[model samples]
Target: MNGQPQWQPISMLPVFTDMIDGMLESSLEQLQNMQAVKDKPHVLDDSILGRVIALYSEQLQNHGAFQEQFNRWKKTGLCATDLAEVERLIQQLAKLKTANETILGIAKSISHATIDKIMAMDDAELAVAFLSGKLKRPI
Candidate 1:
């Protein structure tokens, strides 16, 4: 009723696949570099340094998992590792999408409802509105 309707968010596939690849590759390179440094003192000045490095690398490996999650999310609209997490993320994403559509529907309905309320006026009110050039043109 004012200007153009507000734009809605569409389900757009990500435009940059290279971005995801670059992010994961950079993350992995950083992890390996750190691991290499951590491994240097092992079997020489300190055994604990090596063991600690091993544990650290183990944690670093989980970053690859984030990339895996990104892949699953792109393919299935859900990013889940185990069945349980899959179910939960699917349910959450479903609820989120549903809520979005619901809000959009509400806005559309409200626009229609406002027009209906205007046209439901009694004969006298309609006459006065029309005579005063206040009635909207039918599209």
Candidate 2:
């Protein structure tokens, strides 16, 4: 419902944070590998790219939602541990962004206009774009 609070229970915050951390870390590793092999004559794996896109999409959504909810939670007063967890998530998201930029640079396939459009897209739109084959391998 629109009026419902989107925040998760405090008890579950760590679990969600951990899941997100793992996903971001995995995606970064995959992206780094892709970068390492960019000079080779290997064919890009669509499945792996798709997985990275999916994970990145999910991470963006979760990060946005968590940040919004955390802002609201802050107004209600949060404990130090909660604050630290949110900060950690924020830092991880930054790493994800850097990794994404590096991979984008390696790809050199996406146009500036498409990059702008992708940057403006929400999670669902990103997923749809990927599914529609708007994003492909050339990186």
Best by lDDT: 2
Segments in model 2 whose C-alpha atoms lie over 4 Å from true places: 1-5, 104-139
How many pairs of residues collide in model 1?
0
Model 2 TM = 0.57
Q: Each prediction's Cα lDDT score?
A: 0.40, 0.60
What lDDT tens digits, residue by residue, belong to model 2 across residues 1-139? Answer: 1344467666676776886687677767867776665643135444455555565554555555656765665565568988787677767767766676666555444331234455667889777866886654335
> Candidate 1: what lDDT?
0.40
lDDT of 2: 0.60
- Candidate 1 lDDT, tens digit per residue, 1-139? 1234232121222322343334344444544443343322111222333343344344334334433453454456432343445444444434433343333333333332234445567889877765885554433
Model 1 residue 24 distance off true place after TM-score fit, in angstroms: 27
TM-score of predicted model 1? 0.25
Most TM-score-accurate candidate? 2
Count of residue pairs whose backbone atoms collide, per candidate:
0, 1
